[model samples]
Target: YTSALHFLNTKIGKGQIFLKFDTVEHDAEKRLLAYVYMKNKTFINAHLLKHGLAQVDTTYPCKHLAKFTNLWKAARTNRNDAEKE
Candidate 1:
């Protein structure tokens, strides 16, 4: 987990990040659904999902929920196929 975080931080660099909050509450335990955009060019969340580094939380409501689900499923399928070989 630490290594993953480090890798993410490196990728983020000093670029501007935009966070779209899904909720108003600032509780630490609550997971806020937000898409992290870097320099208005990359969708960080989708990249993470596609690389199998993140999982889709179906309980949350988001505009990109379906896209995230599909990316997750494809990543899992690819991983499974690779393992079988």
Candidate 2:
């Protein structure tokens, strides 16, 4: 969580941020869950997954589920390989 927060901080002021909503806009408690993108079209969700800083939540279906799951798998594999070294 801290790592994700720090990385997001670095993105601050780089450009305008945009949110991409899926089927559900928010959870039961009114917390938002959306894909964040930068003005230049940088995908923050994939970035976090690629860096092993975020986990893929498969509880709900989303458009990027397959892509996110793939990225998360690759990141986990990379981390495991690095640890084996």
Candidate 3:
């Protein structure tokens, strides 16, 4: 997680990032889900997912559930493919 966060920080590199919270209410743990968008309009969550650095928590409902699900599947597939290679 630390290495992944460091990679994100290097990529962000003084650039501005905008966090857009999901419209759904916070979970029981009071954790608010959000999407991190870079200045260039890139979705940071997608990047993390693609790199296999993040996972989808289907237990909680969110606006990006479908997207996250797809991302998670793709990440798994990519990891498997790389391992096979």
Q: Encode model 1's per-residue lDDT on 11-33: one tens digit a residue.
A: 89777888866544233576565
> Model 2: per-residue lDDT, tens digit, 12-35?
545689999999888778999999
List the candidate 3 regions with Cα displacement exceeding 4 Å: none
| Pairs with backbone N, CA or C atoms under 3 Å apart (clashes), candidate 1 | none
| lDDT value, residue 50 of candidate 3 | 76
Best by TM-score: 2
Which pairs clash inside model 3?
none
Flag the better candidate by lDDT, 1 or 3: 3
The residue-level lDDT of candidate 1 at 5 comes to 76
TM agreement with the true structure for every prediction? 0.78, 0.90, 0.81
lDDT of residue 43 for candidate 2:
95
**Better structure of 1 and 3 per TM-score:** 3
